[model samples]
Target: MTDRFAAFRALHHGDRPLLLPNAWDHASAAALAARGHPAIGTTSLGVAAAAGLPDGEAATRAETLHLARRLRGLPALLTVDVEAGFSDEPAEVAALAAELAGLGVVGINIEDGRPDGSLAPPALTAAAVAAVKDTTPEIFVNARTDAWWLGVADPLGQALERARLYRAAGADGIFAPGVSDSDTIGVLVAGLDAPLNVLHRPGGPTVAELGRLGVARISTGSLLFRAALGAALATADALRAADPAPGAAYPEPPSYVEVQRLSAPPGAG
Candidate 1:
């Protein structure tokens, strides 16, 4: 646990910002691991949507746990986006953290955003972070503040305030997902005591630019999952349109055998 935690922490301090891609399921995680990504994070949106539940409302705790348990044997470090810790009670959240830690999960992302579109009280969120650390000291608790994401006025100020509280509560990193501007990101990078994580927007700063802004980590959040869904719809549309003559050039996908191999046990031939 200590070694895995240390490796995840080290990724934040590398020359370039750690490109932490978020995965939805076993196959997605295994594919990323096979591509040599050092770590993989579970997307809360993907988990919730895949289960036909809503995200950020604490509605997918069971699904999140099931995915975490299944992902434990993969060859990469795993961090889970357990939306709002799935409960407001610190003890319950801590218990969840302990469970994930036992499954070899090295990190977790807990947000302060509520489904009602309000930020959770900073003190309450801080208590949750403290509880998780107390329960499993080795798990990297990434305290997330969605001030910018909620479109709150003075989002930077709100985020900075939460950052201080969560960091003092023993968070290893701070994630502000909707902060996209260079100036705000640089300020967060300088102001936060722990590593600052920003979401990677498509048209916004590239990974290299974010690295220059001193971001320690860049999260894809649910972009990959959403993109996959979009691609699937587009492919279906193309297939239907090409039914008469099949003239369109279809995109090649992995063979069934290759996808089947992804589900095999790590040591199985």
Candidate 2:
């Protein structure tokens, strides 16, 4: 078997940031793999919302693990968004990471945000990173801090502080979502030691612009799934507007995922 953990780790160190698309399930993952995404991630929001479960809570451990199992045989490398490892306990989170690694997952994104709209103690995320690294030793731990998203003052400072802790604890990357400006993002890329991951917001900085800022990873978290939902509704609206549901060859834009896939993250090099 390939050392996919190492392979996925290397993707972050490339000349360009790895543009990772988040998938909801096997079909999505497989479709992404078929389209040549070398690495793919699972969106916690997509997984939970698809199953009628709440996201950012400890409600989707079973669903996440089941999705991991189904995607184990997928062609592309996979990382899962565990949403704070699905537990406040470090041991449980570490156990979950180990199980995912055993299921052929290459990486995990463990955030520090709580479901109740506040950030967890940074120590919890740090300890989880330490424990996960101790157990698996190879899984790419993308330690996520919700400082910006949680509306904390000095988000960059707090994110950097928490990132330092997680890196020291064995995180391979630092993900700071909701920091949108170029200057702030560049500052983060400069301050952090590990690869910096930014969530791709629609109409925000483009991939090339972000790569120029020295980011190493870009994640389309829940966007593809949400876009699919919108697309389904749009298709229905079109059918409702026409008599007899007339269909035409609509090949104008690429598939939803393909649009992102084509942009591909640019290289800082």
Q: TM-score: which candidate is best?
A: 1
Candidate 2 local lDDT, 1-269, one digit each (tens): 25787789899999888999999987778778878999999999999999999998889999999999988876789999999888878888899999998899989999999878888888888999999999888899999999999998888889999999999999999999898899999999988899999999988899999999999999999999998887767677777887363345222445787655433433312
On the 0 to 100 scale, the lDDT of residue 223 in model 1 is: 96
lDDT tens digits, residue span 1-269, model 1: 58999999999999999999999989989989989999999999999898899988888999999999999999999999998899989999999999999999999999999999999999999999999999999999999999999999899999999999999999999999988989889899989889989999999999999999999999999999998888788777777777653335345666899889999999999
Candidate 2 ranges beyond 4 A from true positions: 243-269
Positional deviation of residue 68's Cα in model 2 after best superposition, in angstroms: 0.6
Clashing pairs in 1: none
Minimum summed lDDT over a 10-residue window in model 1 is located at 244-253
